[model samples]
Target chain A: MTKYKINLILALVFHLKLISQNFNFDSDIKISEEFRYFFNDPSFQGQEDFFPSYSLTPKFNIKFNDNNIIFRGFFRHDKDIRRTHVDLREFYYQTSISQYDFSIGYHQVFWGVVESNNLVDIINQNDAVESPFGNDKLGQPLSKFTYSSKNTGIFSFFLMPFHRKIVFPGKKARFRFPVVLNRNFIKYEKNNKKLKKDFAFRWNHYFDIVDIGLSYFNGNGREPIFNRNTFMAFYPMISQFGLDLQLTFETFLFKFEGIKRTADLQSFYAQVVGLEYTLNNVNGNGLDIGMISEYSYDDRGALAVNSLQNDVFIGTRFNWNDFSGTSLLVGLLSDIKYNSQSFSCDFSRRFKEVYKINLEFQYFLNIDSRELLLPFFINDHFFKIELSQFF
Target chain B: MKKIIVILLLIQTLNLFSQSNEKLGFEIAQKAVLMDQGFKSLSTKLKMTLKNRNGQTSERLLENKILEQVEDGDFSLIIFNTPKDVKGTATLTYTHKIGPDDQWLFLPAVNRVKRISSSNKSGPFMGSEFSFEDLASAELEKYSYKFIAEKDEFKIVEAYPVDEKSGYSKRVVYYNSKKNYRVEKVEFYDRKGDHLKTLRYEKFNLYKEKFWRADVFIMKNHQTNKETVLEFSDWNFDVNFSRDDFTQEALKKAGN
Candidate 1:
């Protein structure tokens, strides 16, 4: 108990130092706390079980001249699991000289326009313990260099020296795998002693009507293959090639992203094509409505782990464009093969200037026994609410 | 024969007078664009107050950066500084002489830069009466002008958008008859040919002995019963801006 108390005091002092040290530099800081409660217990848990969690995140940013540095930390405590964990979402230093820019440390990069899922984006590893959905990611450490020109395309090169493994929830947590994963039993295809550096390159350009991006990646795959016998995660060596294109017209935006990957377990291709159209000022009351539709395809069929072989997604976004900045999005994803479907709604609004709230609800309907995601479907539904205050 | 000759001369003189008025009106519009040229760049702070029909008011603060181009329209950046919900949000715009302008928005919460499609230009800006197109610097080629009449010290002129998709069908501008040729008031008509809004400018300030700026500008929406008033101050010109400052990547740091 004494040791824990001392640690807490040290953390408080460190945070105060960071806030006071930016006197001569331009800085921005925000601290937020959130609480999440689940209404239903997992099928594997007893009826008396309860699931609730709380977290605190602090983000710090400082800039000088052309250089920028950012650091974000997350600390969470779960009541049911009775465990505490700390994670670093991002810590990076970036600078630019002339037309060349460089960044080193941990960061996250997102790409793709499809609303259903990400087909080509693979820069960061997923933080599965944070959310049931795969939108959150754990920051990856790397050195990135880029050169941009007006006439020519922007070229980027990434050199990652270390690979971080994924983390799963504890046995008492909900929405987790049926079997508790043993991190000690995990296997790596590459030698741990040797510097098995990963490499990637991308080129992006924009024209009057269309924008294009081409990328090639040779590294450890983000998705882990679970060995049923050992209950362990195995990351294999993989090489991937991806292409993304977007065409912007008057009121329509068409987007497409496709990727082909070769891995130790299987080699396959996947693609997502979609478009979004907006009805501006629908009633001339400062309101806008946007409709989005997309189709996802994977050549692996039933062999796909996520079971997203053939699926269709339809969604609509409403922007009130009012003083509170209220927006709501509702989407449905339906599987063509098994007839399984999932519905989700996301709503967010700002109360005044400093306070905001976000609400998300997800429900899964109909599960075929042959589906690979049957375990997740058993626990079918969850709702989450987050209220944040910015400083 | 003398009476017929006098009537023929009168008709010819009226035709010449109308022709010169058209030429003079266009020349004056062109002069307004030229007078504001060679400013190199400008930086200013903005305070905006919005009021609803119930008389409730909200305020916002912003910083603006503008860089004049050699041949293109202009490059400008706007960063929200207050209303903590939107603080550190920035937008970078590259206005062009023709075709659609390029716009990008940076969201600090998501740490993402999104390329906004050109169609959203007609949408209101930050829930204010001013649309995105209204806040942008006016380009002469984007609209065609015609002189309507002269009243007192103001010249009334009508302008129409070249693009049919524009939100406004036509706008009547009241230009100051002074040599500076500043805009005093504007009346906006919606695409359905209904008068939608009116803007009034006040407290004109002359800078560099050549550029004219309005310290107070108010926009009243007749349909929505809401109004927005913008006050500008702390004007700084020629702040040594470069093309690098206008890029999408630079938008993340624009708030600083």
Candidate 2:
């Protein structure tokens, strides 16, 4: 005890000396506002009219030396005022020492590709019902550490040994509806504790142009709802493994990933591949083309028929200097097997140093069994506008 | 005797002109960098407005302070103000001549400050268009230069980067013939040997009749499609700043 106390005191003194000797501070404040409205057909549950959602995210970042001690908060107000919510999106303190970097508090950890659904990134399970694009909150506070080296590679480890409040579908209900409630506490007992851990290793030897990585995690597949305490205590254990590889040659880049999950004597897997190429010289304008496909298989094939999922997307973006301030992107997402397609276009313009504007339009056609398991078909459209300023 | 005197005078004037022009462009290039350096301490309040698509706007106000000392190279402190949660954070940077610079950030909430790696120096600074390399003090030895244009009272020279990691492959600077110092403008070239950006200095003011400071500087990035306007006012030089002022303890106490 005495030795530990002495070490603590010395450490405190050393830090104090370092702080007193080299003090510097800088801060940047960023605020963003987004407005989105979607129109759905009668086949969907929601009304056909416009429904607006607005969010304001404010971020303040501070650092001492090379560590980041950031505090972020967000407030969202929808046309449905009754559902307004204020959230602490990010409240993390991160720092690095030698080859090690770590972060604590509520934060987002993005590790892989596939923006909407990252099979390789399993740390934070997201809300599936909130937004189809998975834009709603998906991360939670935990502890994370990374050991990285430019000459060698990187190794990372993460752990979340605790649970927090969550919302889930209610039990014994005629209609499927989500209910907000605290997670069951009885499971915290020493004998019933559930510990979640994730590990990843990445190597980039081809001049940072080619990257390969492997990741593994052991945890519950998603947030859980209580099941008569007895059944809940027997939660199924899940094991997931993934591999990622990316290559950049000259102006062309390629990325590929595969993930597999094993649980309850069953197995599922997904694979993704993407490619992007830049036009060598077309008045300095660059063009990128990308495609993504996802497949899933259940060894048992008992729960859902077909047990296979596939999605493909194609996009094109154009930038011109004469318009020095304008950019446009158009893309299409389709389930070829189901004959369903969705098209989206986004355009942005900067008026000056003080003002910028963006508009997005999306339309979905023939969304049948490919959307959800339901046989219903409908047409939907969404329009979103955003304005921002930098001072 | 008259002919000899005229010839000598002409030679002397030409020699002075050549010397003045030789260092002028280089000095201006150096001055553009030096004016922002060697501050014992500094504090500022700034407001940022972001304009995004869809016609929505957001703004934030912040206050910051910096303390600097030239030891071996550079040792400094940076502090941020606003959003009480991050009020007492600081960052320290130390540059080395042989290798890369070392950095550290201290967080009051965590009660710890950690060192930064060298690889990250090429990354963006706080999501802005500026990179870490743009923030470092540029040493004279980091580049080689040659006079490309010599006009009546000004000289233009091109500088090539010696540091392999520098964001710009080359830079062109314009200097004044009379001062043997002061850069009027700089054009930066990207790694692909293309003109990438230009920095223009204006509103020059003489400090202590020895130092020339430009009150306004505009940096435009062509590739990233962004620009930054830096306006400096209320200048103070050679202020009393001690080594203790740059320490971590000083940072916590000096919180804005």
- The best candidate in terms of lDDT: 1
Model 2 segments more than 4 A misplaced: A1-37, A44-48, A61-68, A79-86, A114-117, A162-206, A223-236, A279-308, A319-327, A348-358, A368-377, A386-391, B1-256
* Residue B170 in model 2: lDDT: 78
Residue ranges of candidate 1 with Cα displaced over 4 Å: A1-41, A46-52, A80-84, A182-186, A226-232, B1-24, B252-256
Worst 10 residues of 1 chain A by lDDT: A22-31
Quality of candidate 1's docking, in CAPRI categories? acceptable
Q: Which ten residues in a row have the lowest lDDT in candidate 2 chain A?
A: A169-178
B31-137 per-residue lDDT for model 2 (tens digits): 64555454455544444333223334333334444445454555555554422334456676555544555554666532333333443433444333445566565
Quality class of the docking in candidate 2, CAPRI style: incorrect
Give a tens-digit lDDT track for model 1, residues B78-153: 9997677677799888788898887777876556666667666668888889987789878988887778899988
Model 1: native contacts recovered, as a fraction: 0.35
Q: What interface-residue Cα RMSD does candidate 2 give after superposition?
A: 12.1
Tens digits of lDDT, candidate 1, A269-345: 99999988988877666588999998888988765656778988899999978777889999998888886888889
Shift in Å, residue B57, candidate 1: 2.5
Model 2 per-residue lDDT tens digits across residues A276-373 = 45442144322222232333323323232221246566666654322224567777776645676768888877554345677888776656553332
Tell me the whole-model lDDT of each prediction, alpha carbons only: 0.77, 0.54
